[model samples]
Target: MAKWKLYWVESDGYEDCFVVAKNSRSARSVEANMNGFDISDATAIRVMDIPDIFEEKADKKFRDWSKIHAPQQANNPDLHEWPWYADKWLLEELGAQFRVIDNEEQILLRDIVYAKKPTGEWYTYSIGARAIYERNKDLPQYDNYDNEPRIDISKQLYTAMGLALTQCHEIEFLFSNSFVFAVSEKQKKKYKTFNDFFKGWEKKTLGGLFSAMQEAFDIDPEVKMALDLFLDMRNTLVHGITTTERYDINTDWGQKELLAFLDLFLSLCDPIKDIATSCFEVSIEIANTYLLKESDENIPIKSSNELLSLFINCFKLKSMN
Candidate 1:
């Protein structure tokens, strides 16, 4: 199967998607997509493959996030729902909208096939990636992440998880997890059990996403205690177990710990990407067997329940064939 080592998609800005999608001008349309400001009013569409390095930064973060849990919708096609999935920007807002006044026809964003208009003068840029119906037998490789702390965490996550006793202390409570009894003690009273304290890490991040005192950190007893608690919190959040939070923090605040969590998650997935991807395929087969109709049209491509699927899909990314 063909791969997008480097690519972009664009629209012809037409109301009739099928036709205009096949016929927008390349140079001008691409210019509009790149530079938000317009030099000319002529309708345009394009995806200029700037130097491969240009997309590296965004792709690096995206692939890392995808490996961790970002389901591939258009981006993470394999994963299920994320908290952000409900946002309108990434979904159907597939590409930036612009007025296609020239001779554009179709509106679907898929591929950039160069097709001329019926009037003989204008040609439009097509938008979207065209994939083969069959799954790609080969693996996908993208830009690599070069962050020091994140990369180190990724390397450490799996080994640390396995050797839990030394690598990480599974403290029952975050508030009482740390040796700093004075500070965490007052916090502990609010949580009856250590698990309850853990429940609040995601919720509590919002409370201190910017504060000085940390809830989790590298090799810190307090951080370990806090993380142990958070793992249970994540479990409860997923399994529908009853939970009350005295401390509520954002699960992801884009902080060092969050980056570390991402690194560790991705590192752990590195071993499972292939197995996970295959298992995901098997699950889809099981799903298809129970579906109302098995045809492509009837198959649901995106769903609110695919978060688990997405997580599994990440297991397949950057894996051994």
Candidate 2:
């Protein structure tokens, strides 16, 4: 038989209340679960109570917030007095728009996953809710940050994004696209400040995009030669060049080339964040384009593949026209 436990951690201390669910998860699996939940230190176990796990950055913030505010609240200490668990849970309406997840009670996004599957063939998911909670005022500031895996290069990109709000120097982006990105070294001379770096991002992006594509795909000499020619003529900015000395910041062929690379690279990267972002975009487009007021009553299916298909079909149709 498997055992499960649900305990709540607070400034006042721990309590055995909600039974979240505890099973014989393997050490590796348990560790992964802990990482995902942002639970660095584990103690009591159970099933029913939502995991109080939180990002390291946000963890201390929540603890302090709890101490000052509702120290007696039996709910998650991080959310102490915020009605976040109650009012603003995410839910998809008929038109794929979002509403409160479960009535007016507080709920975690993960807890309602299985139940939130789309009513049709395809579905969409968003980590944005997580991003939103991390930034929203209702939740304790620290409840939103996860900092342990700062060494993971891939996730480091996101960690940098989270830390961006705090002005913490974890990762610095040379460029930011829908899902594609390139990070710069701390000692590098490419950018002077956060604002300066991002301001000139689109210009630097094409070089990175071209490089990413050339690496991912084995392009023929003819295609590669042609691409190089066009890139130089239209978008010939160098990626490694990180100086404000005299760089052009125009929406030239470089931006277009880089955007192309981003489109292709995202396909390979499988960035759930971008996919989820696009899913919401598609949902809103569908609602505004086809369905209107009745959109809220309809649950449409919009998957990454479907979005790609729509993109291709629209291109084909436009070419035909």
Candidate 3:
């Protein structure tokens, strides 16, 4: 058997799919069947023979498990519902939505829009740009005109940090209460005029909030550090860029520091993702599974709570594979 890597374009963007087939002909057959196209006429489909990295990494583990579980797999049809099997099935089901693209081709946002358009809109736009340029080739081009100010957080690292923190907070919030409380008898006495006293406990910054959380609850040190670094990096970005309230992603060290911060952020947040996934399995999975019908269509999440819960479930489901 040969392994093949398939690169396909979809509505969201690009995806890489791997499959195992008996031969070149068998791979083409599988690809054709996956897209519901006539095998002889499917021009968009492409496949490259490659070694399967997953099998290469987990060969021994899979072999050991299969020795004991192969019989059970044959006996139980619902074994397909397991994460590995389910993910493969889901990818196959979604195959019809993707058209094969050349692996070497760098797909731009415009390429996706062009592929989706029914008419030759892409050609028209290209022709128009060429015409204007051809007529005014002597026009002086200015460099970096009215460009947005550059900053460390404004680049790719900022986006990664944002997403990582968002993921971390999804788990953190479940155990954290947003509201403040008085811990001491003296503080509780402020209940006589609670309205003015409550403001005293409000955290001013993300660091302050996490610090307060640490004081009130048994927070993991790693989790606290993650929160602190995220806020500190953010503040660095802000002060480094703007005068008012803003967090800068880059410290004084430049791109190297930005990368270092991003590395630290991911390392800190990775285990929290695992923890959150575990919590989601225990707290949200069964109830949310029945909320939406099991179908191929993209269903709208009806509320913030439902969306948040479903988002974590997706993370949990993804981690299972």
Candidate 4:
């Protein structure tokens, strides 16, 4: 009994319509029944779940309760205008990569999920698209940005990526202070940032951090390289040194470039997000375990063993790798 909403437009731009149904397929069926044609004939049809909390971040029209059952509901707002729902779901379904840039007030998402269709079209559900909409919402050129985004999505993508990684590095430095070796009083005088504080302890470089991560977690070396490359890409983007040339993605050289980009992007994002999420989950688990440890008189295991077991189960998959 999950509610759903459908959005559709005529092939020739003659009409547009919306419908509510129990699920996606039924929405299509509803469209067919109204149009006097087979469901297969419906053009530009899309179906999305109308969850109960849709109004929190989305428009009211997206809820299935906005159905036109009476005259009062006839002039209800357009469900297609609902923000962020379709793009978020579509990107998620396409295996979009997300990086968390944690901060004191809130967490930010850095998405590097730019993939192309076989026909050389860029997928629009990306941080780049979201950025474009936010910056140019008042501009005439960006009126239909969600449906038809900027010609070069990669440009905005790299910019978003640069900022995302910069913030993520700051976040890492913030959370990693307790784990890093303590610096001597003399060496501590040289520390300006959290990164300096950590690096000062063992005279380590960024490469050292990568090496330690690889040894401890068996993460791939290529992932470290990709992280290094993001800094370079960020610099190029900020300095306006990024170059572009005409190249169809269907061409062999273009295909190679596309594949290489996707591989590197995913390599950098997937493992880092996994580790960060696991750290958050394990912290919560331990906080709960601490309460249980204090309350129970008949503790089967020591507190240290309980914490180890909690971390072990939390990262069982990583251990398997």
Tens-digit lDDT track of model 4 for 33-151: 66676766655445344554533334443443445444455355544433222445433433323331111111112222233334433232223323433444663432342244225
- Candidate 1 to truth, TM: 0.20
Kindly indicate the candidate among 1 and 2 with the higher TM-score: 1
* TM-score against truth, every candidate: 0.20, 0.17, 0.26, 0.26
Best by TM-score: 3
Candidate 2 regions with alpha-carbon error over 4 angstroms: 1-115, 120-321
Residue 190's lDDT in candidate 3:
47
Q: By lDDT, who's the top model here?
A: 4
* Per-residue alpha-carbon lDDT of candidate 1 for residues 110-129, written as tens digits (9 for 90 to 100): 33233335454334442211
At residue 17, candidate 2 shows an lDDT of 15
Every candidate's lDDT: 0.32, 0.32, 0.39, 0.40
The TM-score-based order of candidates, best leading, equals 3, 4, 1, 2
Per-residue lDDT for 79 in model 1? 37
Q: Quick one: how many clashes does candidate 3 have?
A: 8
Worst 10 residues of 3 by lDDT: 105-114
- For residue 157, model 1's alpha carbon misses the true position, in angstroms, by 15
lDDT of 3 by residue, 72-143 (tens): 544442332211211233333322123322222211111111132332111111111222233346755323
Mark the 10 consecutive residues where model 4 has the least summed lDDT. Answer: 100-109
Off by over 4 Å in 3: 1-155, 161-177, 180-203, 218-231, 241-253, 270-321
Where in model 1 is the C-alpha error above 4 Å?
1-36, 39-176, 183-321
How high is the lDDT of residue 84 in model 4?
Answer: 25
